[model samples]
Target: MSAENELLLIMERISDLTATDAEIAQFNAWCDGFKAQEIQVENFDAVSERVLLQVHRRINKKPNVFLPLYMKLGAAVAVAVFIFSVWFFSSRVKSIEEIRYAADIAPGRTGATLTLGSGKKVNIGLATAGDLAMESGVKISKNASGDIIYTIMPDNKVTADAVNTLETSRGQQTQVQLPDGSRIFLNAASSLTYPASFANKKERRISLSGEGYFEIAKDKAHPFIVDTRGQELKVLGTHFNINAYSTEAVSKTTLLEGSIVVSTATSQQILTPGTELINNGSSLQVKQVDTELAIAWKNNLFLFDNEELGTIMRQVERWYDVEVIFVDGISKERFGGGVSRFDSVSKLLKSLQATGKVQFQIKGRKIYVTK
Candidate 1:
């Protein structure tokens, strides 16, 4: 494409918030070419200043012939963040119209609620980092690292029958160490219910909703069973991730280490490392997959590998604690990239906007997607 067309295309990509990886790569090339042509614009600051001057000059010369409002707005943002490309772009300024419907919601953090067996709720997010509670002969404490630990006393001969639940709301996450030394990292909008002390239980069984990553302590005699949605994962000792969000199309169980037997009402399969068992309705399928991408949320990163725009937005909706509403319907375009979960939703949305396939309008905490 010609230089003018290429610039317009980049601006268009920025406006629509649907820029593809290849398009972003091409934009970076253009930025390099611009730098080579004008050596004075050596760094991001210089590029931002030059782009700002150029944008103002264009507006001054042909103020009546500006691009569409959205395009102009997007282009302005793209120009501002051109130096950083896909990974980091936070210098963009919001237009007056865009600001009217802007959302400033922060990303999810380490926060959750602990429900004692007595139905009392303790907001762990607000609780101090010390002894949280003692429930059912199990000593529950919050360590300095904000991790919940359950320690059972040796001398106390009380096998109490009580179950405790840990839940994380939208824009929050929490980790808990079970009595058996197993660790569970609960994701936002997820919950895990288990017995306070597993001493009397036949098996280490836990029920999960939403999503969580598990690292089961090795105990071949007492198998660890996870009940999620309509599927059950049976393993002796393993590390895996389960994504059973109600809004998700399917329930997925990805294994990272050890072995697991994933079963449903209709089918069963054995999964090894680097494998995932997907449950769609009553059907089950197993396939080799990338475990890192599956557990990206636990690592504080949003990793999307060829995921549909609608699918990508669903994750964004949960992490940013926002609502997503498609203007006509969901955008079918797919996205592939990774961004820090701690960044503003605008930065993430701006990266998507560069794809040149879809557009986004944030009104309060709701995101409207359109083509």
Candidate 2:
């Protein structure tokens, strides 16, 4: 790795945490290099090269973009020195809490609302353990830890008509154990609708909106179906993630463990492990993608692989329940790295600001972006 790139990685990895043994050794080695005046911070992560085109025009991305935080500091005086001090000081410290602004926002939490077919809305965050309600031949309740669970009832009036919806708003997320035993992790501003029981159903089908990671239960006789937006996915049993947020410019369906067939109005394509099917309005496109990045939210991490700023902000807006306004219009810089999603919003923004091209101003619930 280039010395500059290594410094970029070292700076970010040190900010949020205590490093591992290998990381400590790496940090020590960098310190040795700096003693010999070898720490030239120019062109950090290739930031000296400018990216001024619209991000959408460059949808085809690099296969692997693991560069850490970036910043430009070429004799620009203040910006570089001040940011370098922060990065260097933070790196030396064992652990420093995230830098806080005059006003800061917290990360999204685990919570959602359950809407019965009868229109009854039960707030999962405010709910207690025990059975909330019974429908069709199933009982819905929360465990001792307040996790949602579905149990088959003795008189399971298993019918296709008993449907329920689990929805999450901004700043909240949720997971549900479907009647068929499939588990789905729903992201912020997303919802999943499924039947109460699948005892007599021909197929285990669910409707989704926004983004979700699905671990489908296998039943050769009953194929699992996930219908979202204008596309449909069919899989006997598999693990996959679907990003169909309406605000996003494209819909991504990535398979991790099994096979799935995604069907649109005009064409149908089958996706195997490590492949993604993208529906970008007019046509469906398939590509080899990093599956982990596709489901990073499900794993409590924000992984960006040369992703556009607009795309990154949409995720931030959904998770923190804030508005991202680009006063100078959207930036075209591509972000590449990974960070814990549970940290305070400023930490994330700081990482982004390290890119040196973009800056952020947080006012109340709004984040004003500038270049």
Candidate 3:
């Protein structure tokens, strides 16, 4: 293909956010070539850089370059492109937000640790797709999609009430299918402990810490019970999310479908879909909430709706496994935004910085926050 046509295709890929790292590097090289040829852009606006594409109408020779420039979405920046002798060009920049780089940290992925009834820990990420173990008349294995699965063996008597635990550390998350056919998604820095077989149990009981999204299998005969730090949630086949991280003083239970009874030491409350029960370690209050936001972490998203900076950073600390040190005089303003949880820590921090309420600097495994 011709050089000009190739440049157009590259620009399209960039606009669509489909360009590879090498392609981006190539584009940058083209820009350097233009500089070598003594061509310069006349205008570059600092604040609303309304794109002014001024390609020099005259040149000493045909510069072997397809110039490149960056445009941050929601921010204005001028861009120019050049190839061969053709000087006139118009390009549309969209979607690709230029993230500030300070030694880029990679995003998190799916991984977890499973502790068997025998107290042996297995790294699910390194385990092969097969029967990981056998205990309590249930077979523990990992599926092709890397999710843990538990299956009951027919005609096999229930052995000891062997309890197993699945845990995910920071920069990790995982899903598991319980022997009762329920599905639970454990968020980063979370763990779930349950019996290997629910065959003889009156209630399919499980203990949870940190955060989890439960999709309980429909079993009206046996209700499911989740024991957390500050609340006990009982339900008969429903979907819900519980956030009871130890670092936070408040715990929440958000129901997505069906109903759940949340019980504290003194009070008991029922939560319907689209509502959340917040336990402030002193009182329990049920309020209507956006269910999506409550389970946003399970959906691989970080959605903050009028959430405090400290509250938001707490989440960042868990998901990225970073220590947050704050200097004095940081704004107490609440901010709102949505960012992909699977992205690097910088992207999330940059989005928060865009609010003009905070700044971040990464040093080793620590994130320093400033006013």
How close is every model to the real structure, measured as TM-score? 0.75, 0.73, 0.73
Sorted on TM-score, best first, the list reads 1, 2, 3
lDDT of 3 by residue, 1-371 (tens): 64444554665555444454445555555555554655443433321122212223112123223323333432232333223222222222221334224455676788899998899999998888888998988889998888999998896787647999899999889999988799999998999999988887778999999999999998988999999996799999899999999988789899999999999899999988999998998899999999999889989999999998888888887888888888665457799989998799888877887665666667678877776
lDDT of 2 by residue, 47-78 (tens): 32222011111222342142122233343433
Which parts of model 2 have CA positions greater than 4 angstroms off?
1-100
lDDT winner among the candidates? 1
Candidate 1 C-alpha lDDT tens digits along 1-371: 54544555664554444445455566556656654544223343444544444444443443323323323455445443444432222112223224523665678888899999988899988999998887777789998878999999776764658889899998999999998999999998999999998886779999999999999999988999999999888999999999999999999999999999988888889999999989987798889998999999999999989999887888888888999999879867888888899998877877787676766678788887777
Query: In TM-score terms, which candidate is top?
Result: 1
Indicate the residue-level lDDT of 211 in model 1: 93
Alpha-carbon local distance difference test for all models: 0.78, 0.77, 0.75
- Where does candidate 2 clash, by residue pair? 70-354, 137-156, 137-157
What is residue 310's positional error in candidate 3, in angstroms?
A: 0.9
Sort every candidate by lDDT, greatest first: 1, 2, 3
The clash count for each model shown is 9, 3, 0
As for model 2, its CA RMSD to the true structure in angstroms is 13.5
Indicate the residue-level lDDT of 120 in model 2.
93
